[model samples]
Target: MAARVRRTTRHSSRFAAGSILIAAATFLPGAESAADAPGLEVPVDYTCRFPSGSHAMTAVITGSIPADGTAGRPVEPRDIALALELPAPAVAELAGLGAGSVSARADLTVVHTLGDETATANWSGLSASAQGITGQEQVTLHAEGSVPTATFGSAGTATLSASDLTLFLSPLQEDGSPTEPAAIEVECGLTDGSDGTLATVVVAEAEGEGEGEGAEAEPEKPVENGGTAEPEEAAPGAPRIEGRLPAGAREKLEAARQDVEALADGPDPCPFPPIPLPTPADTYVAGYTNVEKMDGAALLGPAHLNVTLMKEYIPDPCTSTFKVLSEAEFEYGGRRQLPPAQGTFLTYGFMPTTATMELIQVGGPAQIESVSVTSDPAMPEYTTVTAEFDLRIRDVEVNGVPLDVGAGCHTVKPIKQTLHAFGTGNPPSGYTVNRGGSMDGETYIPAFTGCGADEDVSSLLTSSISGGGNYIKITQAPLCVLNDTASVDCPAKKPTPER
Candidate 1:
């Protein structure tokens, strides 16, 4: 049997760079950015485990991908390849085993980041042709193949970085027969503290969309009344809407929308076929609700939410709603994984069954808009939050009979709600953003649309479930500090309805 053992150490091993090498690149000052250059050149260090021992290898990856692409369009990278230089010691050992030639196949993982949203994809099926091995001279393996394409859903600057490379080596005799060891699998990880950036691309809005028409409009000066000033007329050359957006609010709104959308994806983690346990989060914010319908049936939920705090841009001028703070300057973005809720309720006093509802946030994350602090005992200290969402009734069952609601069954308009929280203990029972507490709001459910897959059931649902005066009671749990074990419950508990 072949002696089986593995060892690892840091060593200055070199790699023959190629278009698709598994490595990070070095960028020189004054050089063209990846967007302007013909291709990217990056150097990466990796630690690989072999039967004899572990070796550290440095490699340079060179490849070409379009510097700019339209949102919702796929961008393909070209001339992707990999080159590896095996140390002479490892080559000699392979030759000693009666193997005359060797070949390899590799796969790599790539990460794409747009704002705070991140997605990972794999680049697989690259191969290096077999080459003869002799004496103690170093051996070189070259690999190249088709790579996956990346598609961005929104407009922004997206960065693509590479990590985690796996290689499969096959040893064979001169006649191409497998050697005694057959094949070897080597797992390699980027060296600690090494960057594996592949490329950065700028994504623009799709065709026929007017996204940057009035880029020069500045926000109106703050007013003494604390309300937003009436918007002035647009400059002669700018597109005229009802009003112009603040100087940079358009850009901020785009980014905020992308960030909120990232968090709003996927099913709710609180119910049915339990989800994986939560990971340690540095911060946590949740919304638990018991929403009562017009007919008294209720929906219970705790939509777990997280946000990226301390962002520097305000995202309101693009909205039709009036601004609360005449001089609001910053905004925070929520993280992805917004939960879709599932619950069962009694309909019309007798029918009992389950329903799957998707709460789609209409615009973006809740906006704080403004905050006020006061030393005078009578002048209250408070902050207001505004958010809008469409309650989509996707699946329903009455008396265990599945209602054929079409995919688009949802409220005709988004349900707009405003919430308030006291920063100080003014009410002693009110919510504080940082500490979490109770919040209540009322929603007007408009008629449902696009209901009924086989037969039109839109009227049936609208008449029985839709109306004004739907009450929503929510309780937010304290922020979970992921790093502080004492302060957080990893994978937060399912929220309990407040009232």
Candidate 2:
């Protein structure tokens, strides 16, 4: 299958949580603002939850004023960014479980009231580290752009805003594996600050079904921590889960079980079954001839010869035209042989007269090759000839392997054939034909002829070829013919005297 083309969209990594924080702090408030007034400090907390009945985890981000303590006067709007890193194993596990590529979208919104109006921006499409996340991961958030002074009141008061972000988990591996998380970093500060702090989280351990449970399941040894009595063992004859079958059924079951046990213990010779081989030849016939000549005059012979043959014999001053139409049909017994390897079959049918000849090649291994044609002697339109070629194969094989030749086995490799045209006038450009003989003023012979001038002939060749074991029939009308004269010492049929 061809791979589908995907349109890629460009995204900004600068908006990545940490980068936003760094940029804001380094460029936001100037040196004057840092020394004049006390800056606002706000602490933010983040939490995440899984599906119902699952555990939830939270992380906190602490915000404070710079050492100068004067960075929050004449406040402007600020942009907050957050970055989360997850363990690699967790990411792989989730991916293995068939979660699609994971992406984060902000579900939280913050509202601030300045002196008069308010503004808002939706934060979405959070990016994560492409690698290194294996176990518990950490995420970072940055808030530095701007917040209304009225919303938070004073730097002493805490301005709280919560966002319920959704983490989309998608499988990254073809064979579903859970994704892993390594660590997360959150950065937050005033719109104008120098730099931001970096934090890290370490994954303690990983536990799941793939891990060995037996080794981890050691029995808790009794200790001096308020233990009372030792567990007593039950009597030897106490009822237990001995079996689940009744006495009579158990007897028969035991007998069958014994037979299976015997077979397993007694087998020495290889028990594999014999493999079947394909037949070399499905069917072969003795008499398969395509052409025969009689008394210097060619007639439709054995083998299928379905083609249009046109001949013109021009004596001293008179031109005599001859035309012959023929078709062949083979009644197959369904006992057909295919080659060792699967391949396309090309069958050719030839028809020739003393002056003209035509050859037609169709696809597939089937019965009929060509059919239905219309031709005329005068007003010849010989520019282009078109013909429909049909293909059919009763049976075929590839590499000695039998193929199912049906609608279901429609896959076919490309095939091409060069049709040879012999005995004719100049064929159209790109066509080669054998030319010979001379009579009257000019001599011309055409070997290859295609459909010309007739509706039935044109339609048949223009239609799409059908597949399957069905017969393929093509109709072609060749317009070019040879002009030649030969003397024969034979008497012409006498015309009866007019009464």
Candidate 3:
């Protein structure tokens, strides 16, 4: 059977937990401040470009922001509530999509400026619950979610302004299955050419640190840009860890040292650095996994490689826009075919059956929709990365019998598979571009089509395999950096198959 996938960059990253404080400036009427200090209403007009057309919307953002904050501490927007009024035409468009109800999530980028330095945070994950669309009148969506925090290590006046706004819409039928298009993404910006300044916060130094006159003047400190600074030396109270010597550890360390020294003398294989920019950088990815069959049988032989020898682009940090410079080149000059997976399992709960399957690439190379990198100001060394992609699967067999699932046999719709990875300083958690990791998600196996060479058996396969929530897990090794050998050596290793 073949499965086709669709990939798009919806929202980038999830906000890491930190301190709390959120406020907004008023550009429209009905802006009010609560007696409780930073609680207020921020009204602004936005122009959102939908697939149908552009429409005007009025959004009232309600949140808490402190008037004064301490430096060296993180400040997160708290109790964020967004009340967006949708135009009638927008409602009609949803009705046209066969949507009885609609739900949405949104991301709004906030820019913070302190003196000449600037930082950014995403006020993301604002979600609105499902509500019926009558298509006769305007609809209102109330979205609320937590946002990422911003840290200021220096004392100054930090200005917060709104930048880009992205909306992800999910339309569903009465039975709860998604509509034909499934999801819709919309891009929005301020209606007028004005900087949507939400609020102004006065940042003061932390308590108990002061300088009196006649004391020697301290050196000028560097301005911070949403990141914290590490101390020059370890704290006296902090514990130090020392590992006991292990046998052969010294010899292994020496061998690794010699290999590094040899690479220093060798010519640099990569001509360019892997930086986040408009320019695309190509890297090779090799992955392996043990696919769990519907019969509770695990395909263990030949190692079901989800993606082998596939090329991907380095994600741009500032924005979510990217272009594929060119199609990936495999050893055969095109798509790389995975070796057929062979395994034996109980066919019908008791009958042991042997099967071989090939995972054919449905489209071209998997599309790298978006890449999001988030670092904690408290622990700057530890960072998290999230990436999304689209791929397809094809071909199946049982007892050496060809299922004959034609080329069109695939998932009825696109399913999203998200993978995450961590940085070097952090412990291994998820899939990272530099160090390969594991990815697990549920995918629906649609009913088989064009089966049976001698007699039709598509119904038998469909009855056994077609359904939602088929679990799949894939592990990837460090990518072979084709353009940057110093970072990652060429000829990436194939990961041992993971459940």
Candidate 4:
């Protein structure tokens, strides 16, 4: 037997009491009929307006649904679909912003379903399109969703009403700006007809003058004293350098050059060094580590160099990329600071989701037109980090070999390296960069180092470290190029005066 339903409240009385009092009728079983069983309904004849020359729009829908418990089936799913017609084909432009196709008959589906028994609605599948219209764009919207099947025991007349529905259209630009549309309309209805009511709300276009002025005026270009003029050329002998180096060592140098270029440009590149190297206790920055130890020896090998190389060679970090940036901090003297040292290092376990590169132009002893680098967030077992830097070559030499240079044209010589020292202690095996107070028989320093490069410059004044170890302090000396007669000092730092 279809359950014996009875209406506890009279629809006439409820309607007389006012729309807000409808909730009191939920308990009344046969009081309302299926057609009149207050279900989803859209406001009668609605309309939305868009200002002239704008892409934004405001829509208002009015209607009502049966109060909680009033109908046989209390729950219902509803949605609103919108379709925009444009005079001309504009789908390509609108699609770029995730809008529907631009054709004479474009349809935009904007769905909304009620949450809980409260009749509260939420917008879903909301999208726009530009396809067919005579001269401008016209937006059309309608409500849709499932309806209740059970009917109210033939007592109160089936009620069909809706609450107010409003919609605002905006663009998803980086700046979060919205463009006003030329026109807008809204409609509402129910998808199912089981027990609930279906209502239709249609908004007609306003006939009067549209809101706002159409489109923004074009800005006038500034005129020079006589007419548009070109920029002056760089002064002669300005050390305008531009060039490219050979593939091998030149790659590493080029990577370093790109880092310098980033610093020279506005946005700050990673403040941390390209590769984390070990540092002496007296100058050690906190939180950074160059080594990890296992048992009494280096965790990976004699110098921890093997482990660092293995980790660095891994293509991906095993952990989430987001966490790697924060982990770069190192602890020193109970406080955190940037490590003070430079050299190749490797870190294990890293993962990155996105990589971005920006081209920059810097004028100095040499003018650089572009710089690029790749960064991945640190991950576990995947913590390796690889960075490459490129510079516009005015002049460059790798191992005393000269390179080619030109404008708009440049060469890339990368400085490839890795970082691995992440734990707290003298790496079990290699040397220690910073030796903290000894603990038991093991030394606890917060850093480690690894040596890597095609050429072994370890014998030269340029020191090459192979594995973990205690932080070593080396005096900062001017770098000089070797000539047959004598050694000439190479400029290590760019002078501020020129900058």
TM-score winner among the candidates? 3
Model 1 lDDT per residue over 118-232, tens place? 5555565466777788554778787776555555555678888878887777777777666777667778899999898888888787677666432343344354433234235
TM-score for each predicted model, relative to the true structure? 0.36, 0.21, 0.43, 0.19
Candidate 2 lDDT over residue span 7-76, tens digit each: 1110110111100111111123232122233333333333333422223333232322222212122222
Ten contiguous residues minimizing lDDT sum, candidate 2 = 489-498
Top-scoring candidate (lDDT): 1
Candidate 2 Cα outliers beyond 4 Å, as residue runs: 1-54, 62-95, 98-107, 113-126, 133-160, 166-171, 174-499
TM-score ranking of the models:
3, 1, 2, 4
* Candidate 3 lDDT tens digits, 1-499: 2121112111122112122122221211222222255675888778999888999887788887656666645554557788887788888898898888877777787767665555455665577777788544777888886554444545668777777788877777776656887668888899986558887778776566552211221222232333232223322211111111111223433443454356447665332334433322333333333223444533322222232222434433232222112232222223354445554555555444454544444445543332232232111111122222222333455555655655444334333443332222122223344455444445555555555555666676667555665555555545555556444222233344433
Q: Order of all candidates by lDDT, from best down to worst? A: 1, 3, 2, 4
What C-alpha lDDT values do all the predictions have?
A: 0.54, 0.23, 0.49, 0.23
Model 4's lDDT to the true fold?
A: 0.23
Error of 2 at 456 (Å): 30
**Compared to the true structure, candidate 4 yields what TM-score?**
0.19
